[model samples]
Target: MYARDVRERVDAGRWPDVAAVPEASTARTAITRRVLRHALGRLPLLVRFPDGTRLGLGGPLVDVHDPVAFHRRIGRSGLIGFGESYLAGEWDAPDLVAALTVLASRAAELVPAPLQRLRGLWAPRHPEAQRGTPDGARENIGAHYDLSNELFALFLDETLTYSSAVFRSLPASWERMAPAQRHKIDRLLDLARVGAGTRVLEIGTGWGELALRAAARGAHVTSLTLSAEQRTLALERVAEAGLADRVSVELCDYREATGTYDAVLSVEMIEAVGAEFWPAYFEAVDARLAPGGRAALQAITMPHDRLRASRDTFTWIQKYVFPGGLIPSTQAIESVTASRTSLRLTRRDGYGAHYAETLRLWRERFTDRAAHVGALGFDATFRRLWTFYLAYSEAGFRSGYLDVQQYLFTKDAARTDGAPRETATSTTARDTTTAAAEGETAP
Candidate 1:
């Protein structure tokens, strides 16, 4: 519809202000066409209109006015650039996700993007994850996760788990899922079966929520993370809670972790490890758990209908937020884990509502601390990046393209046969039910 309107206006000799011939100098015209073609030329995709006319322009050239910057974004960040550019007002799209969906499905056939990507292969990989050289694990973790602990705390429930919460019990605020988050922590602890004097291992222990909570319940906890900032804050948190003696935060890669534990739990961290490393991730978990130990793995899962993404969405996330992050379908995770471990998927729980609630809370928290965010030295453009990250994430959960899943895997539990226990209070949680259940089930 937008493209058709633009075309009709152009044909009537009433082009947009930016489209005027004088408005575009020789340099600008050459730059605009070159950058637009370069981004769009790679993908051979189309959008069909109601009248049966087709309108497609490869990659989007919506609000991007600076040709030089346009080239840099696609050439440097690929898909991430496209999104960041939009947030920075480099371009505009009427329906961001829809445009992205089209491009992502056709990304493999795109040639120019690969050629552009090759141009930077010789340049030292920017310390980004996914494509770049290892700047140590902490670099990217800090780049994204450690942006503002206070901001996270403001929105996240008291537990500060930062992953999807199991709303075994839904809360009235369905918007924030605060009550459900508390239930989620309880569920995770229950699955772990940590008792007084029990030893536990927590992988991707963001902010040390589970570790501290377990320690509070009298279990000895060892938490591992790649982020130095997280460690510093986590150590402080443990000390503040007087759990420093029982809860230890260490900086080590999950693959290199050692020591046996009675229980192992990982929350929302597997996606960052890349699909190639999942086998190793599970192997390390299995090796660290003692006989009869169990593990609870929580993560974001893609719906079955979301077969693919547009080039824009794919490149955006890969390049900017989580480099190397892959939200594989449920089958992918099940297949990978089942291939190696004797571990059985004792319980599989997905709550799209909880995630929508989580994102809503995060966005609100981030907005509340917008001034502090600005104080972090990020200019307006950078602020836009963060804003878009939060907004799009919420949109994703709301659209049902994403999900939050908790998969309980047991090593040698005697009671590995039982189903998830239901709670009377679970039915009260309703926020995520409407949005998540509706959006998540859709393509």
Candidate 2:
């Protein structure tokens, strides 16, 4: 705790110093220019600065509103400071997602290879205080999810599903997002084989959509969540859906959950498990799973090398977005399960492009409902931060730097399969899904 306090104090003092500085040092500009040239040269991106200066060969434009601050921040903090620039509104792009996609495509090479391993020397460590302890988890989860249901409502579809939505195919626009979201959940429910007489356990119930769906299928569900705001509304939604008798919503930690379930599922919740407690999280799932039971998880994953290199390093996403979150690679998940538990990775369906489209639709919806979001008491800065977050995520997928996947994990893989799936697999969505699948996909 003392160490965390000291680090927080240092960061508090440092960001102000950076923000107050009027100009970058001559040496800093030289470094920034060199990095930009190598980093942006291969990409078709145009970077416009305050002084009418520009960089990049030219695709979409990155308008650097405060070049000096940006340069200084980059010189000091590297990629994280670039995100801070976005939060500070120091830079923008004509098409934010497109411009970010250009950068995300080169994220691996942005700082040069030799320096990548050196990130530990300066990269922020995930704070000790933010570990997923019972109390810490609630505080961190509430920082984003419990802010306001109305705030999320401004942007999300009627379903209120916050994670990546899988689509049959990438839609051209936002009009089809609602149905696509249902389809996404449908696939997970299918993977878990939720049906009549099934005793299902769902972790991280986001507004009761999954629970409602499970109940609709005549399955009895016990759903867990940390957000009080979400729990209230989720229960209300369950009652409204007239499935209250079949579904139970509890305000509890995953570690606190008891009783066995015939099937277990969590949607995009493992990211918040923190690497330290991943084993415990899986253990909780294992303990709750009945013999021959199945588990399906939707995850967001990064490439293995990137996940390994950056898993312990904190970033803008951890700072201003989802605190205590980490995108686990397939290797990390497989290794954790193999070493720590009996569950085996049986099948995976990945659709990174689908996530890009899902994010695009959410960003558009968020922007289109800006006034409503503002009226919900979120300030302009909040809007900017969230906009950047959504766009940044969209870019990650667009560049194939990130992927969303559904995985079927079972205790007995040989005994589990041959049941009919609700949907066919796709290279993008489900067609490519297979029981023999071996690569990583995310929840």
* Number of the predicted model whose lDDT against the real structure is largest: 2
Q: Could you give me the TM-score of model 1 versus the true structure?
A: 0.67
Residues 328-436, candidate 2, lDDT per residue (tens digit)?
A: 8876776776566667666777787778888888898898888899888776566777898999999999898998778787755432322222231233233243311
Return the TM-score for each candidate structure.
0.67, 0.87
lDDT of 1 by residue, 87-197 (tens): 444454555444544454444444345554554442223333442223434565666777667656655666666776545434335444655665666677776677799
Clashes of 2: 11
Q: Report the poorest 10 consecutive residues by lDDT, candidate 2.
A: 417-426
Off by over 4 Å in 2: 1-30, 413-443
Model 2: lDDT of residue 123 = 72
Q: Pick the candidate with the highest TM-score.
A: 2
